[model samples]
Target: MKRYLFCEYKKTRRKYIFVMAVAITAVALCWGLYGKYNESALKSGWMMMLYQLPLLNTIFMPLLSIVVASRFAGIETSMMKQLCSVMPKQRLYDAKLIYSLSIILLSLLIQFVSVYIAGRCFGFSGRFPIELYALYFMFTIVPAVEIYVFQFSVSMLFKNQAVPFFIGAIGEFIGLFALFLPQYPWIRNSVIWGHYGALQFVGGDWDKVTRISTFYLMDINWVMFAVSILLCVAFYFIGRTLFVRKEV
Candidate 1:
């Protein structure tokens, strides 16, 4: 596994996967932080972030995964025939998925650190909830993993990277719209792309009259969260099997 992983890393060194991911993360962070500089926003900045970041994640993370997965798979579209003779298809599939995830995870951690720093710099009131942040990380990444699996599978199956990219773009719009439709919990839970919004643990209340905003903890949708993890696992096996059986 390590050998396969190392080989993937080497192959992708020139692909700018890390660079692109960092750029995407920065964009999302900036979007989340914009217009949040007012006194009211700063006072409840931590909770505001908790409320807003998942929405950003729903918009950006799937597209990030799509780009990264497409790049990883793009390098192999013409070379799969050669690669299969040299390595087991399953090993290759696993290595690519694991390696791509490592890149995504690091990108997310950087985003978290950036948000923390921003909170400190801007002096967000209220104590930082380390436990909630940890759960936030878990909730955020699990859905990303599920999305990555779906993206990677499509990337592997189709030589045209645009197919997966198009799917990702459309999925992002669907997921973003779904966030506003909270009345349908089942819709949010079932859409893999919207799980970030579905599992969000924080909710914000804004007073249009007074222009006041307050944040509160919402119930964690554990059932949906668990369902996401299961989807990731199931997709991994299903994708791997299809890739192995697929003729190179």
Candidate 2:
């Protein structure tokens, strides 16, 4: 199993590094360049970047997931349908899920580093709160795995990649933007991850009867973490079910 995954890692590793580097470079340049307007612009850029970090998941994860899953699927697509059906069903299903998830974890490690670099460049005022960044990595990784497993299962559902890729793209776009609609607070709490990102730091600055009307919300911290875990479990089985029943 280790050998098989390592081989897949070798084949697909470039995409992870390339995508993460691009995201980090783009984020840094956007903030670094926009910082020239004024000191406030720089500060706002920093704050904005912090709030928008979760947006990275939506922007990069989907296409990355689709590309990785497609690569795995492409390899297995050549096998005869009967060959898969007659094999040890558990091992066959496990191989696909394991390969897809291993790549997802690798991509996530890159994202964690990239986001940390972006945070530092934005200029941390304090010790950079290792715990906060750790949670950021944890929360972000849950969704990354969800997107990867979901896309992998979707790819297996159809031989064609276009439809699954499109669906993943559309789903990610909606999930990223849900924070903007403050009126629909349920969406803000339940579906939107940026909500956690905001409360994580932005809470400190929420001025009462002043410029920033928002404040720290500690109410849903446990719930958000729980939901992320739930998503991981939910998608694992979902992908497993799809793969187990899928035709070769």
Candidate 3:
């Protein structure tokens, strides 16, 4: 498993997926910083940073997952068929899942570091919300796992990367619209792409002029989190079954 994981990492790194994910995350962080600077009356820049991270992740990370998963699976479909033939199909599927997850973790790490730096730069004051940070991390992972599984499945099942890539792009656009449908939380929560916004049940309110935090919560949408995990697990098993049956 280690050897297979290492091999996938090398191939994925060669594809520049890691670089692209980091670059995209950096851009998102920069955008959040820009927003913070322009809104002077905002209370708790740290809270804003935390709130925006999941939104950015929702918009960009799924697409990143699709691209990375496609490139990772492309190896087998393109020229590695013979090499794959020598291995059990389930092992290959598991390796690909792990590789996709590693990319997700890398992206999350970049986001976390960037947010911490940006919060400090913005002069956020008061106790660091360690509990909130842990909850944010958990919330971020739920959607990420679902997106990775859904996109990775499509990428592996179909040899053509364009199919999954387009699907991911479309899903991202739809996710933006999902935010406005707050009246129907279930509608948004049901889709993998919308899980980011769904997880943000707790949020912050700030004064328009003072920008000082007026209200915030260390709470979350537990139901959405649980549903997302269940869906991710289901997707993983279904994808694994399909992948094992797929012709190399």
Candidate 4:
């Protein structure tokens, strides 16, 4: 397993996968932090950050996963026939899956640290809200896992990376719009891409006249969270089976 994982990294070491992941995270963070630090924003900066991040994550995380998965899948598809002759198909698939997930996990960690630094640097109000941040991390990572699994699966099955990328782009469009349907939570819950918005524990209510936003803790959708995990497991097994059974 270690050798295979290392081999997977070696295959893409020149591709600057980590660099791309970091760049995406940075862009999302910058976008979320944009806007004037007004009175209301200053008062509830931590919560504001939390509230706004999922909206950005809904679009950016899947995009990162799509690019990473497609790059890895492209690498595998080109060399799969030769690699299969000397290696077990399942191991190859597992190696790539594990490596790809590790990349995502690292990106998530970077995002967390970047947010924390931004909070400290900007002097956000209230305590650090470690518990809330923890919940945010869980909410973000779960949906991301599901998205990555589906993205990776499609990327692997179709040598044309465009198929999975187009699917991911469509999902992003739907998920971003689904955020406006908060009154109909089920609408967001219906799609894996929208789960980022669906599972968010922070919400913001803005007063149009005052031009101020109030951020508060919202109920976490535990049921949808659980469902996402189950779906991720299903996707993983289904993807692995297909890859293992495919004619190299």
Candidate 5:
């Protein structure tokens, strides 16, 4: 497994995955820095940056995951019957799942580093909340995995990348719109693409007239989180089954 993973990583080094990861990281960092500058006066610089991380993840990660999954599956899809005849299709499917997930994890790490640097540079005055950071990290990763599994299934099920890519593009727009209609929290939480906004670490009440905001640790939507986990498990088995039985 290690050898296979290593070879897969090497293959990705020659692909656009690394370049896309870097570009996403750079854009996210710039946006966070800009948010830090604008919200610094509100005395929630750290929270502002942290909040923005999830929002960025919500909006972009689906598209990114789709691309990674498509590329990873492309290896097998391109070869089709020849590759399946030699290796167990299940093994190949699982490896591609892991490969795509590793890319997602790399993207998450970049977002974390960007948030940490922004916090330090903006002089967020307090004992750093490592606990909050850890929780937020888990929150973001769980939904990301859920998204990856679904996208991976779609990518593998379809030989043409355009199909999955188009669906992902539409999902991206849906997620962006979901962020605005917070009154219907379930509306967003129910969709995998909107999970980042659903499982937020920090939330607040804002007075429109006074332009004042008070922040608090947002309650974990345990039900939604559990549903996401269930979806991941379901999709994994379903994808594996479909791929194994697929006529190459």
Candidate 6:
């Protein structure tokens, strides 16, 4: 069972990494060639080069989650929950986390690098507040888990890659448009990247600007990450139970 799970998870992880690398690199190339339409920091009010990069996480991450989550479910369809029940709890949980985390981390890393490269090419304020970058690193972990938790949950519920992927797309669109509405500022509170202020880490609260740009959180990043982690764990176990208990 362990061997099978590892093989399947590894296969997906490999594909996820390869595809994301190519896609993000292409995105960086585009940024270097043509600014994000008129949204460039210079044209817009952004004083920073990094600001010129559209928040990729706002759109791409969820799309990736949906694509990968549906693929995860589609691939796992042949196996019943029994496979998980037979494995030790730790192994089962770890396998799932390793699979999801690899995807999350790789995508984040690629996006960060893409931004840096674009910044250098465009001469947008390539300067990021070191402290803000660090905080962005720390706080982003929660958003990553939130992405996976939803992916896994949605996959389990629909068991169709298209269903979850479509839902994710719709949600992404709505989430994007919602932030523009004055009445919907509260809705922005729930978005993962919505907390850009943390990215302003080096600037900190000493500067009012950091306070304005950082994503305000209802709870600390760690707490949010932990909660999402716990939920994913619970969802994995529940999925295993359902798979195992079913008459395969």
C-alpha root-mean-square deviation, each candidate: 1.1, 4.6, 2.4, 1.1, 2.1, 6.6
**Alpha carbon lDDT at 150, candidate 3:** 90
lDDT of each: 0.89, 0.59, 0.77, 0.88, 0.79, 0.53
- Candidate 4, after superposition: displacement of residue 132 in Å? 0.5
Instruction: Tell me the deviation in Å of residue 31 in model 5.
Output: 1.9
Instruction: Please state the error at residue 139 of candidate 1 in Å.
Output: 0.8
The per-residue C-alpha lDDT of model 4 at residue 86 equals 90
Give the count of colliding residue pairs in each prediction.
0, 0, 8, 0, 0, 16
- Residues 1-248, candidate 3: write the lDDT tens digits: 99888877776666787787777777776766675254542445667667666677777787778777887778777565776668888888898789778877888877777777767766777667777787788888878888889999898888778999999988987777787777787767767898899888456566678746644664567887888999999999999999888766
Q: Please list the residue runs of candidate 5 whose C-alpha ends up more than 4 Å from where it truly belongs after superposition.
A: 35-42, 207-212
- Tens-digit lDDT string for candidate 6 (203-228): 11124654233222233334445554
Worst 10 residues of 2 by lDDT: 211-220
So what's the TM-score on candidate 1? 0.97
Instruction: Look at candidate 5 and give me any clashing residue pairs.
Output: none
Model 1 has an lDDT value of 0.89
lDDT-wise, the better of 2 and 5 is 5
Q: lDDT by residue for model 5 over 1-248, one digit each (tens)?
A: 66667757876777887678668767766755674244534477566556667777876788678778888878765577887787778877887788778878988888887778767877776766788888888888899999899899989999898999998888877777898898988768768888888888687677898776667777788887788899899999998998888888
Q: What is the lDDT of residue 184 in candidate 6?
A: 50
Clashing pairs in 4: none
CA displacement after TM-score superposition, residue 161 of candidate 5 (Å): 0.8
Model 1: runs farther than 4 Å from truth? Answer: none
Report how far off residue 211 is in candidate 5 (Å).
4.2
| Residue lDDT tens for model 1, 91-134 | 89999999998988898899999999989988887898788898
Q: Which regions of candidate 4 are displaced past 4 Å?
A: none
TM-scores, one per candidate: 0.97, 0.72, 0.89, 0.97, 0.91, 0.64
